[model samples]
Target: MTARAFPCALGAVLLTLALAGPGRAQTAGPSPTPDHMPKPGMSAPEMADRAAGRFPQPVRVGDLPGRFLLQPEESQPVLGRVTGLVRRDDGGADAIVRLDGVLGLTRLGLQPLAWSGVGARLVAVPVEAVALLGEYVALMGMTPERLRALPTFAPGSATAIPPGETLRIGIVRPFH
Candidate 1:
């Protein structure tokens, strides 16, 4: 794939990560482990907070093992929920999800995440029911069958997918 085939929007997601906010105060969160378990069917945001140790249950993103999830738009679960729908472009139907109802990305702290000069890079993670788009990716729509097929591993290990390491769960770019 000549880098261009990947999509401009997608390139932007990576740039945002490289520029992730210094992070608030760097709370003394739980250290990663190798025996973390799944959330037993929790929302992506819920899972993230749990992993962050904000909840009494304290869910660790690293505890998720090899799961497919991005950082939550908002740390505090509010009155809004995430929705996914399909749009027909030309003769093709594309899957789309708004990153937090439009302004979610800004809330996620991706400021000045301008596109990198431009290039192609391969991103890999072990998880199922993942729909990869140009700039962002989604995981809430996954089904049991798909979830079972994903690769889950020990938590706290480098093999684990770091929280906020994955972002743009809501699509915030034009698919061109």
Candidate 2:
């Protein structure tokens, strides 16, 4: 088409689209379903929740028989600080923890796992664990504040804990 005609044609198309408005321009299409997609009514979040809850009973970290803790050369001892601890009615406690530094690991080690971060998690610990927080709380070389200074009942606003980072007790059973 001629240059003059081309401009006119483009203008007409733009005008048509503008007049059509967003609603009439395009109708919502059915979401694409992947071959390995979860079953209907079972969303990804729900599936994850179900998988996490599969292991109801909590196991001790030291009880795991095997060489699982075998350190790959890349793995560094990440420091974990206990920011808050709340005692549960069932004798277990909810702990708000903050992980320090990024510890690089192989794909088989830390891939698809968000373990290193500020997280508020439920843990299986005795009520007395609060009193002995210092022994349980380990932060490498840095000297943490007094045990009483840390929030022991609920997460304080100053902590600014992240959401969806709650690690279940069954997975990496809490220490203390």
Candidate 3:
């Protein structure tokens, strides 16, 4: 496929995966090997926490950019791409996500038709609400409509988080 078509194809595949539902079998091949198991010293609860992306770890602010923002749910899932980070006066961080319409089609380089009355907007999502699940950042209990309704993020008015700062973030380890 051409470079332009690749993004559309990828979006379609992701939409398909989202529609497949979490209960559906993701792979037809045999189960993964034991190499995907948790760490040797990790307790059962720790392993469970890691699987849920609740195990917090100190991570640099610079590493957060470019991660895809995902709302993982059984229903329609919302997707966005992180553009930057904002530092709040409370010493917390927020992720700037580019959301277009309900599904964030703008992130795929497609604009919603004028008749649809949808447009792209940047929203600041509290880092506390984020879960680092593998390479994707998961936001639980969020919907596209709710995300779209959030106040738009203004970089000029917000304090930007420096790349060197460290923040404690929850991470999901597929293989710990």
TM-scores for the candidates: 0.18, 0.21, 0.58
Q: Write one digit per residue (lDDT tens) for candidate 2, span 1-176.
A: 99889999999999999998877555599755432222344433444454344343433323221211211112323333444444455534444443332443332244433453223222222212212111242221111222223343333423332432333332222331
Q: Which digits, one per residue and each the tens of the lDDT, describe model 1 over residues 29-141?
A: 88542222333455645544433442122223322332323332323122122222222233212222222222334346555232331211112222222323232333433
Q: Which candidate comes out best when scored by lDDT?
A: 3
Candidate 2 residue 47 C-alpha distance from true site, Å: 9.2
Worst 10 residues of 3 by lDDT: 35-44
Candidate 2: which pairs clash? none
* Candidate 2 off by > 4 Å: 22-49, 52-122, 125-176
lDDT of each candidate versus the true structure: 0.32, 0.34, 0.66
| Residue 34 C-alpha lDDT in model 2 | 32
Between prediction 2 and prediction 3, the one with superior lDDT is: 3
TM-score of predicted model 3? 0.58
Specify the poorest-scoring 10-residue window by lDDT in model 1: 117-126
